[model samples]
Target: MAKQSTKNKLDTSALRPLLRYAKPHMWLFILSMVFAVITVATTLYAPILVGNAVDLIIAKGLVDFDGIINIIIKLSVTVTVTGIAQWLMSLCTNKITYCVVRDIRNDAFAKLQKLPLSYIDSHPHGDIISRIISDLEQVSDGLLMGFSQLFTGVCTIFGTLGFMLSINVKITLIVVILTPLSLFVARFIAKNTFKLFHQQSVARGDMTSLVEEMTGNQKVVTAFGYQEEAEEQFEEVNLKLQKVGLNATFFSSLTNPCTRFVNNLVYMAVGIVGALSVIKGVGFTVGNLSCFLTYANQYTKPFNEISGVITELQSAFASAKRVFEVIDETEEIPDSSNATVLTSVDGTLDVDNVSFSYVPDVKLIENFNLHVKSGQRTAIVGPTGCGKTTMINLLMRFYDTDSGEIRISGEPIKDCTRDSMRSMYGMVLQETWLKTGTIRENLCYGKPDASEEEMIAAAKSAHCHGFIKRLPKGYDTVISDSYSTISAGQKQLLCIARVMLSLPPMLILDEATSSIDTRTEILVQRAFEKMMQGRTSFIIAHRLSTIKNADTIIVMDSGHIVEQGSHDELMAKNGFYADLYNSQFAVT
Candidate 1:
């Protein structure tokens, strides 16, 4: 019902946002309009020269040969000038169309970077990508069509109307009186088609998202024998797109034919009226009637073209709305004017009575409190959905606590600049990410200016050196974040190497070793243990055996800390921690 109401409220107001992007290229648009005027002026004037040539050749022997030749020369000049002006007009419009869309794409991508993690978490990744890429492309096509046809169409209509009025006002009035019928037909079709076009745009985005998800994880789909089910899902979304797209195309297609029918009626009426005036000897002549007929066609032709422009504009506006939605979303909270920049972080952290939830009504974490001294290794263990990762999010300031204060190195995190605060910690998550670049580039991502020796040393320490050397190009081999070119374990090892390259004052390993094999995990664990010395570390682990030597072990359940102590002390108590540890290694 809400969507129905939104469709019903479609108006020209949504196009206002696109004007902001086009403003910088306003001069080019104005130049195109100027060229359009020259094109129209020359095009309309050529008919007058033709009418004069017809007047010169009165009757067989009464023809004035020299006058006919002069009119022909003037006609040739007008045609040449019109061609040049039209070409110039097209060139300017092309530049304006491409430049405006380019600016819009840049702004949309920059906005994506600034949005809060909650927004990214809630929305489908494919849909966001569609708005950025596919929707913007639609806007470009619409702008191009509008520029090429709309400006010249409007100018030609008015220019031809003036020429017709000068020839015979009575016949011009007949053309003007019937003009509204064409407009009415175009408007009726365009109004109904806008809703269908908008629906088509949304369906296309959904299809793109589904395809991205299925294809990116085809291995999982195949492993689970979900191919048939995936095909059914694709068919459902594809059918919805097909339905709306067909309806939109069907109605928009009616604009050209229906307007042309009305326009033809107007043309025939002018031809009859002008021919009768010439016959009755009411001051109209054969040449005047001929010129009026041409003017009449020129006048109504724009209605047909303009109607087509209206249809394309409707689709463009729908796409623009989607792209603007991303740009207008609320961004992450900005830093205060006097936000501190901590150059020397001691890695001390304090979570005081913190509470948070992704949704307002359903609480995930409440009154969560923890304190860690500088250089202490803290291991956070919990069952699935126990807010362990949420704690890390809070520490990294990816999402702020709803009702508490989190201080880093004794200063409130809210008062610190986000870049400086985030720079204090090097993070590696269970789900690895590596950009499309060389191995050395991925390792040096956290520290761009690191020496080659430092990069190889980190890779060696992470036990990925063997694989790195075996690759065709060693450190120069290119890789993508898709994890297609390399094994997941290799990707994880590269991520570990990334953190080691930076060696920030603090570290976060959230199931960081889950992808690697046991032998490699043991070797990486040793590297991490060595790296954690004298630096504060937060390890979110599921494998109990991996974090046995952590300085502090925090066991959590349902967003609350149930037990916390050293490994020996927690085992002695035999409480929640003991049961969790024993359950993992329990006998059948």
Candidate 2:
């Protein structure tokens, strides 16, 4: 849902959003341009002074110490002022570029929070990371360099044209004629290289995705002895990246030398024209002829620079487009204008005639109905792809149902504020996620003001306190993906302790004890019994030992509840439920 197919071309639409982002910094941008103009205006004087120095030498021999000294002083002062202005200009440009990038990054990340779960499920993690990090860095850094050159190059072009025309209109016409050739060369090369850069960008994302996937599943790769296969896969993606990168850079690199060649031709024309004018005596002083020659060189230099700016700007535009693509995706369905805020959840829930399908043609759940009394343990057991997880997702409102309504405390959940609804539930999923932080900090994430006593008590109950206290820094030790000083089972125990610390009115424990050893599982189950009291709890477990004593057991198959009862009731019936139980335990 997030990825969109775009034609291979330079789309100016990406720049519109960038211009909008820049609007807040409009005055700052203008001030930067002012400094740029000052720099270029001062630089334009050096050539004129050089021409005057030449005139002085010819008019008063080469021994005019006073005239030479004065010209040298003026040249030095001009260069100093120009350098100061250039420095100021760079400061303002960097400020604008980075600020704009910061806003873009913020919006892109915020967009991810609002995007549908399906969008995240469908896209690769590394591709999304590339768009957020690498692509944005490219856009900002490239624009910084490209805009700096463009601002100065443009001013130099117009400023040089004015100086040349003032010196001699006929000589100025020489540049006006040859300048078109340089622009033509630039446009032709840019057109070819723009698409190549875009292709290279896509290839870079592909390479990142492959590497991330391989790294994340390293254990599986090694166990399967897939090293050679993984390396071959990487080489395929790396080769594609190399090919496109070479082509894009190859074409982009051609612009400078090609434009310079045309510029050199313009310079030769000016030299010839000035010498002819000097010979023909068209009332042009040697100083004026020399000034015209210098102006011609200055004029042609911006053309070469502008060409390079065009190449860099294309990469910036391509990255900007990728970033804007994410920002522009349709946001999650908004809460109601006057949404109800759930409070004091009673744990009562009713699923009425609910139907859902990930794909329109393949219905996963149809006309599903269920109800659980307040403060009861409801267990859902099902085979893979039997919509057990989907039901949990609906209960959490991570996804909306296609039809019918889900209610909590006899009020429709759709009308409740999602934040308030979610705040009522404490979830410990099968997958454990812990950001880089101390154990105490991770425990207090859902309840920032939790007391130290509450944290230690919950850790003790969840059978995690013993292991945590053994760590180097105890509760203060920092943990991360790379710096995991704990085992997987220990990590799961921490997750349970986190939920125990918060102590919400409702709970979701999806295979929460799967990682713990058999001995640890028994202790955790005692903690769960205490935690589940006076609160609604939903548990999805593959091991029947944990849920055998649940207040209600629901068996789901083919998107429908096939059998549901207490352990004794289902076993007495001796139907599908008895058969399923016997299959798991009746080993030959």
Candidate 3:
């Protein structure tokens, strides 16, 4: 079973990974703590100066002008020093926290690149985005606040307690007795609220996912008149989020007041007990009693602040746990240590005795095998869920074969470095992805070092140059997810052009032209023919007509290739391929 964090206890598992990122910044963190200590020391000492001033006024009345001036000057210097120290601590702590957060974000993103697509397919994109962006931000915020306040808060509490004890132990005992009440209140609130905050974080992620899902498919939502339905579904998720958020906030909000009430009781006890001690002539002066009261307030004030911050800390802890879960997922089964870089790829391929399944008990591809000559165009035709794409996945090593080897150019793929092996082929998916950048930048995405002449030639051949030139800024125009400046067909053409520019030794076009018009498909198919010269290509086309002239056609059913031949040969046999081919032209 996958592990889950216990609500109240911080998952040390999560903390260990976070600290791995923080290890390099250890000195900086220690320095921040030192600065915090200095700030707290100077701050606590100022209360002593205040007590001296009060004693000065009480001992000599208004006639003590010189003494009062000296005390004022000392107080001014002390406050100024404390402020400077506090500022320094703030500066160092912020640097340390953000730097640590930066490292964790970088690692989390890098982990995504190395993860298998199966993991991505099973998980929500919005949740992954939340872990990287929103969750990390929450974790960063908690660290920032903690670094700034934790050291100082801790030091002041103990320091003030010590100072109070020296001033009057009897009154200090009253504060000690009452301090547990604040802790208990904080604990009670924390125990109930941590689980709520965790649920709140999950709800927030679900809400982000809802927004992403709706906005990503706004066209479908509008085309089918699903606006009302979409809004209603969204309202359900939003309402759940509101309920979880309200409960979390309400419970956490109680901490401040409850702790403050206990603090007030302690304050009253300090005042009463200290007054009695002074009256009984226990050698506690008015100044000492004044200092003791100040110390008691100082000691307890941190508890209030800490109690308030506990809510944020728990939220951050939950976010950190989520982030670490993604990072800790077993990485794509690593290539062997002896794996060699794939080079001199000739495109000759062999799939030998391969078997696979998405689930252990449900077999998909069973002991399958195939071979293709170098520089040949192979077409794969199959109905949906016939293991067509799964075959491609195995070829690219996005997944491993269950029980056999795939060889490229007489070398086992398992023996080759995955990066070098995968780089040997160019792929175009059914969906097009264009970043928010200028036209030239997107065109140069794969081959950033390609010459302007090569990029322009690729675009012209892919039929994308005309549309790109028509944009308001031409090649320099910036675009985003809305794709306002181009149509879906144009985006696909650009993606094709990107692949053409890379010009790998082999190509895998999985529904590459699905978005284009029939007229445009002709142009793109012609370009594909031109690009296929002297290079091996694998075409997974639903429209069998597109691959009529392919050098070899492999027809698949379930997980096995049922027939193999050219169009005329398959038609002569009148097998499954022929029936499938004929069915496409049949009237309903």
* Clash tally for model 3: 0
lDDT of each: 0.91, 0.88, 0.86
What lDDT tens digits, residue by residue, belong to model 3 across residues 260-373? 999998988888888888898788777777888888888899888777667677777778888888888889988899998987799999999999998899989988889999
Query: Over the stretch 1-588, how does candidate 1's per-residue lDDT look in tens digits?
Result: 786466555545557777777888999999999999999999999888888878887887999989988888889999999999999999999999999898999999999999999999998999999998998898999899999999999999889988888888899999999988998999889877877778988999999999999999999999999999999999999999999999999999999989999989998998888888888999988888778888888999888988988899899888888888999999999999999998988889999999999889988999999999999999999899999999999999999889999999899999999999999999999999999889989999999999999999999999999999999999999999975568989999999999999999999999999999998888998899899999999999999989899999999898999999999999999899998899999999
Q: What local lDDT does model 2 show for residue 299? A: 88
- Candidate 2: lDDT of 500? 94
Best by lDDT: 1
Model 2 clash pairs?
A: none
List model 2 lDDT by residue over 1-588, tens digit each. 122224233456777788899889988799889999999999998888988877787643455678879999999999999999999999989999999999999999999999988788889999999999888988997779876888999999999888888788887888899987998999789866767777887888888888989999899999999999999999999999999999899999999899989988998998888898888989877887778777887888888888888888788788888889899998879889999998778999999999999899998999999999999999998888999999999999999999989998988889998889988899999999888999989888888898899989999999999989999999999997544869889989999999999999999999999899999999999999999999999999988767988999999998899988898898899987777777889868
What is candidate 2's local distance difference test score? 0.88
Candidate 3, after superposition: displacement of residue 203 in Å?
1.4
TM-score of each: 0.97, 0.97, 0.95
Summing lDDT over every window of 10 consecutive residues in candidate 3, give the lowest-scoring window: 1-10
Candidate 1 colliding pairs:
none
